[model samples]
Target: MNGDWLLRGRDGRLTVYLKSDDAVLCRAELAPGGPWEPFRRIGGDLGLQQGPAAVGQGDDGYAHLVSWRQAGTGESRLVHSTHFRPLLAPLDWSPVGHPNGRGDRTGTPAVAVDDRRRAYVFVRNAGGGVSLLVQKERGGWYPWRDLKGSSIQDQLAAASRESGLVEVYAATPERILHWRQEEPGRTPTRDETADVAARPGTLRALRTSAERTTLFFTDQGGELCAWRPGGKPVPLLQAAGPGPVAAVRCEIDGHDCTVLAQRSASGRVAFAAYPTEQEQAGAWWTESGPPLPPAAEIALAVDAHGTLVAATLDPTDATLRVTRRKAEAGLALEGWREV
Candidate 1:
């Protein structure tokens, strides 16, 4: 099945990654009053791609993408695209050598870009270990460095230029690894077994402020938990209810209002807007209203100014859907053509 999406900043503009049937990563630009440009296919040498990361915008208006390709010798190659401009299809896209890490089952690689357009890749090794790799601007890739000894699940976390201290949390079958790069090029401070529990899927990070971050993951019992440093992990939602949560997302509205998207097992989407009175340390979530339109895939990201944007595929119609909502305005769901 096609996967849901998450957003990361490239330059000033946001880059959206959508898995397409053509085996190439599709990208588009979103600007007010501007048209939703056609999707550009970022190719991979292998028959299909492992997926691409929207690292950020480079020095010029070029977009930076990092992905993996399977080598003819049966090794996984971590590749980065040259600076690419929207609308102008790249004459040819290639991978950056040097900083290479062992690749897993073509899963999406975790990526973050600093202000200088340098890209960082975190991937699970062949033996299921977690490692960090870096590529400096205009410099060749650096050799892969093992960040932790424990094996990591596919889900990994990272932060970029605006994200003051980038944090990476990877879960092993029995433990979790929290790696923090206080600053680029500096050795990453390691926090081993931050939590002792198997987490479902990947680790997702949301930066609430310059110094605040919230980490989301599901425990072995299938209950969702939110973890912040200097505090304990709180149960966002328990699994003993109507059904297990299929998905979860954190969104910031105007006025710094934070909301969460929870997809229940019954195919109902829950919009939980946190109360403004509580602290960010806990899993506290207040219902916004109802579920979103049912679909097979959903992708969401909030803008720098706290605008919530989401895209989903309509199961019945087989079409792409994009939605945006301001602080006070209700959701605006439209097709790709409408965006």
Candidate 2:
């Protein structure tokens, strides 16, 4: 993973960044049928501490972002921004679950949002252990709950607004673990576990439909794997050579789903697909280019009618690339030259 792009969602619109090491609340938008907008500091200029950011929408339909700023004493402050404005003069978020506590020493803390607009943060706890904490919808942190395993190479969690269930995917010593809120107001339950040849990290999930949920993860081998509930997991095409596989969901065409995976080191990318229940069941993937240059990052958004809008790093010149596909074309991409 590049570790440069941070994911954020607000008012059903998602924004990400390719370069955030310098800008605060740095974000880029993929306009419909338009080129990617340049990186602009959306929220106001935050002083010294710039990174460890996350974005999401609230029940009130406003966009929100939370960033961890480093203090001079090496402590961290949690800054919350609502609708692109910082709130409460920057809360001192030194602790993993509170302001007085301390967190992981080396890694940047991560945050996520649930359907109810609540945010959860995953970080190393005060006990020198990695764990997750629930930030209630009303804006208070909960107790730090230890994750199942010790080393969380990467942790990702999302809440489905449609199902009202929170899903958390983590990498542990044993395998790739998936946890979902079993019922409303109840703690999440481990729904499934899959053995990973590579300590699976870099996971992404898409609940395209109420009955369909898909997950993408990069194993220890740096290869990509797509897990579909009740179906055999599909292996994504890895760029030839040694590197991490970056994959993002593009769109859903009827029974066919599309995803774009980029090989970082080689800058090669492949547009892959999997058949739904109405279609055949098997691990079938197709590629586009001859493993050309790599892009900075990839972003995918599907419209209500199932139309796909893919925003990715252009291989030829390293600019932004966008592609749209309707259901009738069979997703057989053509003329994907750099624009």
Candidate 3:
């Protein structure tokens, strides 16, 4: 599942972007916790490949979206479009030439928009190493640069911290490899000190604080774990399903807390809340709604009112099913509704 399928805008409006057979479609909330607008095609008319898609929103409220279109042989040509401001509408998409030449076979890409409004797109190169393409100051893109990683999984993550520096998290069978800029507007270097192990396709990185990013992943024991750059892996939940977990740090009961939306072992959407980085203090998890199929993923976001919003694309009908936690009602969830 893509991390950005469901995300709230800077103005408190939530937008969901999904990949269909031929194009990418999106729906924007008319207002925060309000009615959603009708789905509109946003990927131009490019022939998109059958793959996962990603979306990154800048501090300016602009969104940078990326998807793959079939290229020569088995490779894919990367195509991108920007939704200027918070409108969540794009006129067309332009081709961002692949790093390994004409889409020479790459993994799923992740996008992170820095404080300067530049978009950093990360992907696994043809040789299983990570490479990234950066958006220049104006509008053009710089050539792809390899980040020196190996055996990296296709499921990876990239996030921008409050300091404006961007950090990328990827997993190999052996350990977790990371790339973080020493400061804003600099090239990210591999930080081998991040010693952690994660199962393939289950690693996620998000900035839960102004200067720190926490990683969520399933360990060899199948338990969900959280880790930071200089800390040990902290077990957070048990029997977590495969794929990435959608998490956000927000307030609950006037306390700073981290909320998690995960697919549980029973194939249901499970949510948990605990004090930020305080696993030893205990956390609570609850499952709700129907047991979803393995292919579907739950998207989580916190609205302007600090309410948690979770949604999943129904694999059967391709419709979006959403639920949100009642404001200040602990972890209580509202009934699921079809959108």
TM-score of 1: 0.74
lDDT of each: 0.52, 0.48, 0.80
TM-score, one value per model? 0.74, 0.70, 0.94
Better of 1 and 2 by lDDT: 1
**Top model by lDDT, which number?**
3
TM-score of 3: 0.94
Candidate number achieving the greatest TM-score relative to the actual structure: 3
- Kindly indicate the candidate among 1 and 3 with the higher TM-score: 3
Q: Write candidate 3's Cα lDDT for 1-339 as tens digits.
A: 355577777788888877877788878888887888888888556778877887877767677888788777867788888876445568587889886876454788889899999999998888899999999989899888989888888877888888878988898877888788887778899885455667777877778788888888888888888888877788877745776788888777888888888878788888888888787877666888888888787787777776778898864457788888775558788899887
RMSD of 2: 5.5
The residue-by-residue lDDT of candidate 1 on 86-198, one tens digit each, is 44454344555323333334344676555555666676665566666677667777677766555566666665325434566677787667777776576466854556574
Weakest 10 consecutive residues of candidate 2 by summed lDDT:
85-94
For candidate 2, what is the lDDT?
0.48
| Residue 267 shift from truth in candidate 2, angstroms | 1.7
Count clashes in each candidate, considering only residues at least 3 apart in sequence or on different chains.
7, 5, 0
Ranking by lDDT: 3, 1, 2
Cα shift from native, residue 48, model 2 (Å): 6.5
